[model samples]
Target chain A: MSCEKQSPPELPGCQEANGPLDFQLRILSDPRLLAVVRCTVAEFAAVSGFKEDQCRSITLAVDEALSNIIRHAYNNRRDQEIEMRLHADIGCLEFTFVDRGEPLDRSKYCAQPLDAVALGGRGTHLIRQIMDEVVYERVSEGNRLRLKKYLPPARLTP
Target chain B: MTHLLDDKRDATPMKISTRELNGTTIVDVTGEIDMSTSPGFRTALLESLKKTPRLAVNLTNVRYVDSSGIASLVEVLKAARISDKRLVLFGLNEPVQEVLQLTRLTKIFEIRKTEKEALEV
Candidate 1:
C-alpha cells in the first residue's frame, strides 16, 4: 500500500476553500489487499465523524468498488495497478478509482434486482445503495469511477 | 462425532474447521471473508454439505464479510435447496447481519442466534 497526501481535485461543490482532506492510494490489483483498504477507509471515515454503522457501510461500498475493479476492470490480474483518491469535505466524502483495464459498459451497468437469487452481481447494487452519487467515466487511458456520500449536519465538524 | 477438516493458510486471513454434532455438520469459521478467502469458504461449505443432510455454520468469530462471502453463502444455499439439505447460520456479528439485511438475503436463509438454536432448527 502506497499513499500520499495531495490537494483535492477541482470538482463542482468540492473546492480547496472547503479545506477538504485529500489522500491518494495506489495498490496492486490483489484481492488480498481488500481488507487493508477497508480498514483504512473505514478508519478515515470514522475520524471524519461518521458513526460506527455508517463507517461500516462506507467500508463495504469501497470494498465492493475495489472488488469490481479487480474482477471486471483488471480481469482478475493481480499484478495490474489501481489508484484511489479520497476527498473529504465539510459536506461530503468522495472516492475516485482509476484503473487501466477493460472499461465498463455504461449501457450494461444496472443493479440486479435484490429479489433475484444469484451467485454474483451484487457488488454494483451495494455500492449504489450505500453511496449518494455513482459516476463512471471512460477516460482516454482507462476507466474512472467516482462515488460520493453526503454527510449529515450533526456529523460534520468545523 | 469427529472433526472432519481444519483448513488454514498462512497467506490468507481466514480459517475454517468442521465437526459433527448429532448428525449435523457444524462449520466454524474464523477471521474475515473477502475475495481472497471466499473460494476456500465456498469449498468448505460445499464439502460439508456433501457429508450430511444438515449443515450449521458458526460465524460468531467472523468480524467482517464482503460481497464475495455473501455470494459463497448464496451458492451453498442454492445447492442445499437442490439436494434437500438444510443450511442454517448462527452467531452473526452486527456487520455480517447488516450485510445480509442490506442485500435482502435475510428473508431467504435460516438465521439463529446461538448454536443450540441452530441445531434445533
Candidate 2:
C-alpha cells in the first residue's frame, strides 16, 4: 500500500461577497478535524447571534459532514485535507465541502426519505432532505457540495 | 479580536443560541463542540423536540464538532424518528458532511439543502 498526498484547490463558494456570514477551513481529513471544525462552528454561530437550538442543529450537521471526509474520502489516511466553508445570512446558513480527489457517485445519492432502522445510504439522502437547498458542482479537479438552510426572515420592521 | 478577550481573561469567545421557526426549532450554533460541548448540542435539540414536532438544524456557524457530537446527533435523530417528529439538518460545513457520508449514517436523518426547504419538510 502507498500513501499519496493531493493538494486541494481554491474552493469557489467561500468567497461570496454578500453572504451575511461565512467560515472557511483548510482541514486535514482526520477524525480530530471534526472536533476542530465543531469548535469553529460553535464560535461562529455564537458571534453570528444564532440561538441555542439553532446552534445544536448546526453543530450536528457540521459534525456529519467533516466526519464523512475523514472516515471515507481519504479513508482516514494522513494524505489529504477537506476544505470546508460555513456561511450564515440573516435567516439562513450554508455549508460547503470540497474534495480534491475523485468525484463521488452522483446518481447513487438519491436523497432517501427518512425511515428508522435503515442501515446506510442516508448521508447524502439526509443532507438533501434537511437543507432548504442542495447543489452539487463537479469540477474538473474535484467535487463541491453546497448546502443551504434558511430560517424565516426576521421581522425587524414589525 | 479574541486575543484581547484572552488577554483580559474576562470574555467568553464562544456562545450558543436557538429559535423556533413555525413548528420547527432552529439552532444556529457557533463554538468548539466536542465531547464536553456536544452534550449541550444534543440536549438543546432533544429538549426542543419535547416541545415541538418539527426541527430544523442550521450548521452554518459551527466551526468544529467531534465524534461524540456525531453520537449525540445519532441519538437525536433516533429519538426524533421514534417520536414521529420531523427533524432535518441543514447547512453542513465540509468537515461535518464528510463525517456523515463516511459513517454511512447520513441515510438515517433528513439533511436538506437549505433551511427554507428543511422547514417545508
Candidate 3:
C-alpha cells in the first residue's frame, strides 16, 4: 500500500529494462472506472507487443471479468474493493483479479447454451471465448479470477 | 488522457441516441456498453422497436462492449423476430465485430459495412 513501492513481489521475473512492465490497479466497484481500466489494459497490452485487435479483445475480456465481479460478486454494491494486476511477456499476457466479495459457484463456471436468445450468463462465455485460459478460485476472504491470453512468437515477413 | 474519459463519464453512463432515415430507425450508441449501461440500451432498443420493425444500430463510437451488452442486443433481436421485424447493424468497429464473430452471433445478425447498405436492406 506504500506509494514508494514499485511492484509486487509476485511479478519479479516479469520485469523489463524500464523496470517492471506490470501494473496493479485497485479501485472500488464503480462502473464509471470501467473505461479508465479498459484504457489502461489496452495500453498495457499494446506495450506487451499485442496487435491493436488483440489489445481490444484483451480489454473486452477484462471488462467482462470486472463487470461480473462488480455485479455478481458484489451484488451491484459500489462500496467493495477490487484489485487487478497485469503481467505480460513475449509469449503470453496474464490478468489476475482479486475481489473481497461473494464466492463464485462452481456450477456457473460453464458456458451456457447459446441457442436461446437469453441475456444471462454470457459474460463468462465471452471471457472463455476471448481468453485462452480462465481460472477461478474462491479464497477465504473472497474470490480470485485469472485470465491468460496466449501470444505467439512474432513472425518475420519476407 | 484521463480527461477524454472524464468527458464521457457523465451521469447518464452510455449515450443511446436515435434518428430516422428513409423509414429505418437508426440507433447511434456511444460510450462503453457493459452491465451498468446495458439496461439503458435495452430501453432504447425496445422503444425504437415499438415504433418500427426495422432497427439499424450504428456502433462506430462504442469503445467497449461486454457479454451483457451483447445479450441486450440479442434480446432486441429476439423481440424483433417474434414481432416479425428486422434488425440490421452497421458501423461496427473491430472490437464489436470480433465479439460477434467469437460468439458466432455474426451469422445470426444482419451486418453491413455502411449505413446506406443497411438502409437498403
Candidate 4:
C-alpha cells in the first residue's frame, strides 16, 4: 500500500485545488488478501467522506472486483500481481484495477438473473448493482477495470 | 449440545465447529466468509448435512460475508432440500444481511433470530 497526492489530468468533476486523493495498492492474487484489501478500501472510503453504509457497499464492490480478477483473470494463480488505484474527488470516487492475467470474456460476464436459485454467478451482479459505472478493457498486457460511484448531492461539494 | 462432530481451526481465515444439539446439528462459524474461506465453509456444511437431517447455522460472530459465501450457503441449501433435510441460518450481522438482501436470497433460506427459534422451526 502506498499513498500519494497527484492531480488527475482529465477527471471531469474534480473541484479541489489540491486534486483528488489517490491511493494505490499492489498485492498478490491470493484470495487471503481479499479481507485486507476490503479493510483498506473501507477505511479509505470513510476518510473520503462516504457514510458507513456507503463505505461498506464500496468495500464490497471492490472486493468483488478483485475476487473476479483472481478467479477469472488469474485463474486462481496465487503468485500473480494485481494493482488497484482509488481516486477520490468531490463528486465521485473512482477505482481502477490492473491485472496481468487473461482478459475476461465480455460475453460471459453477464450477471445471472436473481429469480433463479443458482450458485457462483452473483458476484458480478453485486458489483453492477453497487457501482454507478463499470467499464472493462483488455490492454496489450492484460486487463483493466474501472468502477465509479458518485456521491450524493449533499456530499458532492468539498 | 451433546457431541462435537467436527472442529476445524486452521491457517485459513475462517473457523468452523459443529455440534449436535438435541436432534439438530448446530454449526458455529467465526470469521469472514469470502473467496478464501467459503470452500471450507461449504465442506463443513455438507459434511454436517450428511450426518443430520436438521441443521442450524449460527452466524452471530460473522461480521462479513461475500457473494461466494452466500453461494456456498445456497449450494448447501439446495443439497439439503434435495435430501429432505432442513437448513436454517441465524444471527446475521448487518453486512451479511444486506448481502443476502442484495442477492434476493433472504426469502429462499430459512432465517431465524436465534438458535432456539431456528431449532424449533
DockQ for each model: 0.38, 0.05, 0.41, 0.36
TM-score of predicted chain B, candidate 2: 0.83
Which ten contiguous residues of candidate 4 chain B have the minimum total lDDT? B1-10
* Model 4 / residue B36 / CA error / Å: 0.5
- lDDT, model 4, position A52: 71
Instruction: Choose 1 or 3, whichever is better by lDDT.
Output: 1
lDDT of 3 by residue, B52-111 (tens): 968999987776677878888899988899899999889998778878876668888899
lDDT of 4: 0.84
- Score candidate 3 by DockQ: 0.41
In model 4, the runs with Cα more than 4 Å from the true position are: A1-19, B1-12
- Runs of candidate 2 with Cα error greater than 4 angstroms are A1-19, A110-113, A155-158, B1-121
Task: Please report the TM-score between candidate 2 and the true structure.
Answer: 0.48
| Backbone Cα, N, C clashes tallied per candidate | 0, 76, 0, 0
lDDT (Cα, 0-100) at A138 in candidate 2: 84
Candidate 3 at residue A115, lDDT?
A: 46
User: Of the pair 1 and 3, which is ahead by TM-score?
Assistant: 1
| Per-residue accuracy of model 1 over B47-107 as CA lDDT, tens digit each | 9999899999999878788889999999999999999999999999888998998888998
lDDT of each: 0.84, 0.62, 0.79, 0.84
lDDT of 4 by residue, A1-158 (tens): 11121222344565553356899999999999897788788767766667677777888899999999999999999999999999988768999999999978777776458646988788888899999999999998789999999877886553
Q: Per-residue lDDT for B13-94 in model 4, tens only?
A: 6889999988999999987899999999999999999999999999987867899999999999999999999999998877
- Candidate 4, which CAPRI tier? acceptable
Better of 2 and 3 by DockQ: 3
Q: In candidate 3, residue B4 scores what lDDT?
A: 24
